[model samples]
Target: MVLHTVNCPPSHPALGQCLRLLAPGDALLLLGDGVYAALAGSRAAAELAASGAALHVLDVDARAAGVLERLADGVSVCDDEGFVALTERYPRQQAWY
Candidate 1:
């Protein structure tokens, strides 16, 4: 599985590029400034869901962005330990920040 961290706006070209390359076994970890993409009803969230890849948002970042309650369905909120677990499960990591 590939781990992707998107720390920019959803409309950014990087997001689209990443989505295009995402496979079923891939996972995305929305952290740092990337937590904004977790907002419900967003195009980015929709794109992510459509990719059929696992989606995760850092709980701390979500809370900081004030989007913790607005997260899209099927998106998991993860802590540091969960992040570590994800890295362990996914051998490749791609940071978009």
Candidate 2:
């Protein structure tokens, strides 16, 4: 399985390309400006929800973006430790800037 970390905004091409490549067992972590895509009711949120990959957003980043409560359904919040755990869980990783 692959673990994908997207550090860019939804408007960036990184997220779209990453989404297309995701499989059912993969995981995706949204950080930095990428957290904006997890905002509830957003098109990006809808797309992410349908991606089939386990979805995660960095807790600190979501809090800094003021989107903790507004995060879309099915998206889990992860701390720094959780990030490290994800890296350990998956053998491969793709960083989307």
Can you give the TM-score per candidate against the true fold? 0.93, 0.97
Task: Give the C-alpha lDDT of model 1.
Answer: 0.88
List runs of model 1 lying over 4 Å from the truth.
Answer: none
Compare the candidates by lDDT and give the number of the best one.
2
Clashes of 1: 0
- Give the Cα-based TM-score of candidate 1 against the true structure: 0.93
Q: In candidate 2, residue 61 scores what lDDT?
A: 95
Q: Please tell me which predicted candidate would have the highest TM-score against the true structure.
A: 2
Model 2 whole-model lDDT (C-alpha atoms): 0.94
Worst 10 residues of 1 by lDDT: 7-16
lDDT of 2 by residue, 8-88 (tens): 999999889998998999999999999998999999999988989999999999999998989999999999999999999
Worst 10-residue lDDT window, candidate 2: 14-23
